[model samples]
Target chain A: DAGITQSPRHKVTETGTPVTLRCHQTENHRYMYWYRQDPGHGLRLIHYSYGVKDTDKGEVSDGYSVSRSKTEDFLLTLESATSSQTSVYFCAISESKRLVGEQFFGPGTRLTVL
Target chain B: AQTVTQSQPEMSVQEAETVTLSCTYDTSESNYYLFWYKQPPSRQMILVIRQEAYKQQNATENRFSVNFQKAAKSFSLKISDSQLGDTAMYFCAFGRGTGNQFYFGTGTSLTVIP
Candidate 1:
């Protein structure tokens, strides 16, 4: 199995609390992405990194931030947790760009905010 | 901006039967890629199949296949001999061939009744 792992498989936090989700990859892929999955919205990109220290915001990046200090690790942080931010977050890594390559995804982290 | 649409909110299929999930996308670029990802109750976003815009022939993997209509901007997923394990939320997505960003649809929930 291509190893992509997300930490804190499940988390519970209170409003205004800070939280961080970690994604680690055993496969050395150039592209890594963070996405949030919701009931009606399905999944939306939150952030993505092309290389170490290179990151960009996705469609739904507000209230969320990401960092990639090393190729194997990408971190997603919530400055102040909110109930609306409660969702399952996934980490995906791809050797090629989104259009033509296969993306391997982590199991996901379900975060619940109160 | 590109947009992916999954018109069907939910679909049901009998065990060992066949089912098709519909998806449509709008993009200006001629070269791109379409994808179907399955998210089970566990919430992991798993790659089901992918189709390149340049390829004329459809793509199939095991019991999963894609009907890609490049000109019509439609990409649909066909699951043959559907199993209970195949019951999950399927998402339609689009991405530029060489770009890292992707556009995703809401999703279609497929239920396999055994």
Candidate 2:
């Protein structure tokens, strides 16, 4: 266990509705990452944070935003959810940006946008 | 940009048998890392094993092992004595020692039949 938890493990919302997913960790790790898993595409990075208030976009960042104001919490928000945006979101944490060690993952959140 | 590829979309093995999942990647960096992750029906991503590109020796974790062919940019996972619990989706990932992003391959769904 990496001491990670994702809230609202399952959700269903209509298109154009704003949605937020929360990832909380107790490990006090320095780096946190958000990824979306979809069939035929594996997992794609959405965003990542190296430190509190420090963030960057990943391969697939369109229509998504992230916030990390504290060491233990990273939040992902969909400004306007779309059917195409439905996916299983995962949160991962590492001790450093280099990731010399393996990353620890949280149980994923499944979101469905109609 | 780096990319990882898992050519097998699905694989099956009888209990107590061994199974190998193939993964290939494209990268110009000589120093990096490779990982195999397992996601069960519960939707939790669990690290099965990891290998550093600089290490000539393969990495092993209990029943899980990796055949890391650095020259060929291939990282294949070998699961020995497969069990019913091993049924899951397996993903291969690549990361540089100094970078924050992890490039993932489309997963292979593995079934361990009794």
Candidate 3:
């Protein structure tokens, strides 16, 4: 297991409120990814950072945003929380960008919006 | 959908028995990678097996093996001598050639009954 950790393992926020989930990694991985897990959707990529300050949108990046100011931290923020945005968010890291699916995932953060 | 498809939503196997989970994807690219990730009740995503598209041989680790068919775009996971601890949700993922993003299937839930 890579030294990856997600903060606020569980969170509850009201609709229209701002929320942020933090993912921290101790390993010096170059690529980091954010994903959301749902019942029927499995896991959908939200955003990913290939290097410091280099981020890209995913298939489900409409309502979310991410920032990677440094190599070890990736922050996912929901500008305004919505009910449909409630899901388990996961952070993953890979040693190289070419090995996209070969990643180590964090414990995951469960967020709920009322 | 270029997304990976997992036909089995749930399955059960007797302890020590063998079980196979199905996965299919749509892609025209020849160089890529396939991965199977296991998520247990602890909500931890663990990488089970990985197969590179260029490899003709299947990938295996201990009791976990993959049956990868490039022409058919099918990648299935086979578990041998299944144990109680094998109960978990399995996800199939597809990453394109040198791409930074991946597509995941909904996932298949496997339960090994003792």
Candidate 4:
């Protein structure tokens, strides 16, 4: 929980539509991450932001994009929602990248694309 | 890129019994961190324990302890006196202290029975 909140906890969208999930944190953590959880896959990183305006791709970044305009907010965008993108998304924040990988996660956002 | 592997897909344990979940990772970096996270039915990620690669001793938290073998790249979680609340999906993750990304395993579903 750690002061992280994801907007629209649950959403159902049609294929080809665009979807944006927002993550806000009051911890002022410098590192933020977006991850997707599926039935068989534990959690796959979609994207992460090390600082404002600096983001990088993760293991499963094919159909995802991310942006961080402020220290407290990070956004994940799906240009065209696909059925394969339907899953529970998690937003996590960490105090530092040079520390013990201690990350605090939000409640999570459940998105279903049909 | 580091990859985490959770070999057990599902497991069951009786109340007050002990259980172990196995995890392995492929990473060339010498300085990294390992973590075990639990996700209950509520869909919240709870950090159970963590271990640093440089530390030879295993990390423990109450009834939750880890058996970390750095040479074999294995990090396993052993839960003693398992309770009903321990039923959840557990994930193993690996991250370089300096990297912003974390690699998670497919997960192991644990069921604790009365």
- Best-matching candidate per DockQ: 4
- lDDT by residue for model 1 over A1-114, one digit each (tens)? 689999999999999999999999989998999999888887899999999999999989999999999999999999999999999898989887544687778998999999
Give the proportion of true interface contacts each model preserves, from 0 to 1.
0.74, 0.74, 0.79, 0.68
lDDT of 2: 0.93
Cα lDDT listed for each candidate: 0.91, 0.93, 0.92, 0.93
Off by over 4 Å in 1: A97-99
What TM-score do all the candidates reach, one by one? 0.95, 0.97, 0.97, 0.98
- What DockQ does candidate 3 have relative to the true complex? 0.74
Rank by DockQ, descending? 4, 3, 2, 1
Report the lDDT tens digits of candidate 1 across residue range B1-114.
Answer: 899999999999999999999999998998888889898887777889988899999999999999988879999999999999998999998878776677789999999999
**Candidate 2 local lDDT, B34-84, one digit each (tens):** 999999998888989989999999999999999998889999999999999
Clashing pairs in 3: none
Q: When superposed on Cα atoms, how far off is each prediction in RMSD?
A: 1.4, 1.0, 1.1, 0.9
Candidate 4 per-residue lDDT, tens place, A20-90, comes to 99999999999999999998888988999999999999878998999999999999999999999999999
Model 2 regions more than 4 Å off: none
Candidate 1 has an interface RMSD (Å) of 2.1
lDDT rank order:
2, 4, 3, 1
For model 2, how does the per-residue alpha-carbon lDDT over A66-106 read when each residue is reduced to its tens digit?
A: 99999999999999999999999999999866546788999
Model 3 regions lying over 4 Å from their true place: A99-101
Error (Å) of candidate 1 at residue B70 is 1.4
Clashing pairs in 2: none
Candidate 4 residue lDDT tens string, B88-111? 999999978787578899999999
